[model samples]
Target: MIGALASQAPANAGSPAVERGQYLVNIAGCNDCHTPGYFLGKPDMTRYLGGSEVGFELPGLGVFHGPNLTPDKETGLGAWTDAQIVAALQTGKRPDGRELAPIMPWHAFAKLTRQDVDAIVAFLRSVPAVKNKVPGPFGPNETPTGFVMKVVPPAKPK
Candidate 1:
């Protein structure tokens, strides 16, 4: 099912970074949450990486929304530095000091190669910027006490 959706976008033609990033984003299933309509196997290309208002409800945790990854200045990552992007993926900490919900899979992503991480950021920068404001996550009880931080292995040697 996921394979059918993987070929929709070819690698970015102009930049190798963007191309690699695009490929990584596709294989990593970033679109599953970051891109609306993607999980249904029909991504809205017009709003690619624009984020979603639809929320995910974790059994004992709470509701969470995916934030825009586009370069939009108002509601996306335009203001974030590439380093910040890498940090978020590694530590699950947003630039504003907020922790991302476990649903973000930062633990798995933390092990991505630095080159891959940089490529992801480059791809994010290359995508069309869209203005979308995702709401903050809401927890049933104060942030889940069962939240356990995982130890992500160091990046693989190239």
Candidate 2:
């Protein structure tokens, strides 16, 4: 499944960095969350990495949709510098100082080598710009705008 999806994107065949980045992104399962309709089993390849329609509902942190990773100026990461992207991935902190949602596995990503992170950013920037405005990181008390997968604590054993 991963191979098939990765193959759909146009590759920068001559750039090793882009290729490596693509490999890292595929292995990291970025599409599973960032691609629209993915959770519904019908990912939109045309808007790959554009954003998710589904949101993850943490117990107290609220709902967060996987944001668009494309370089769209208005709705994606186009405004972010390469350094900003790297920081977000490695430190889980956005340019605005907001921490990534709990569901984001940035802590695991934090261990990635600097070169690997750079490659990831390069690959993200190379993808065709997709203008998608993902919905909110709704507060715990706020109602979310789309389908959500809630994370609940396991019940105590009897």
TM per prediction: 0.77, 0.95
Candidate 1 TM-score, true structure as reference: 0.77
lDDT of 2 at 64: 96
Candidate 2 runs further than 4 Å off: none
Pairs of residues clashing in candidate 2? none
Q: lDDT scores for all predictions? A: 0.76, 0.91
Point out where model 1 deviates above 4 Å.
1-12, 39-42, 141-158
Error of 2 at 66 (Å): 0.2
- Candidate 2's TM-score reads 0.95
lDDT of 2 by residue, 1-158 (tens): 66657575545656888888888998899999999989999998888999999999999889999999999989999999999999999999999999999888999999999999999998999888899999998999999999999999999999
1-158: candidate 1 lDDT, tens digit per residue:
45544444533647888788888888887877877666555777678788865666665667677789999989899999989999999999999898887788999989989998998898888787888777657675645222222334578999
Candidate 2 lDDT score relative to the true structure? 0.91
lDDT of 2 at 67: 99
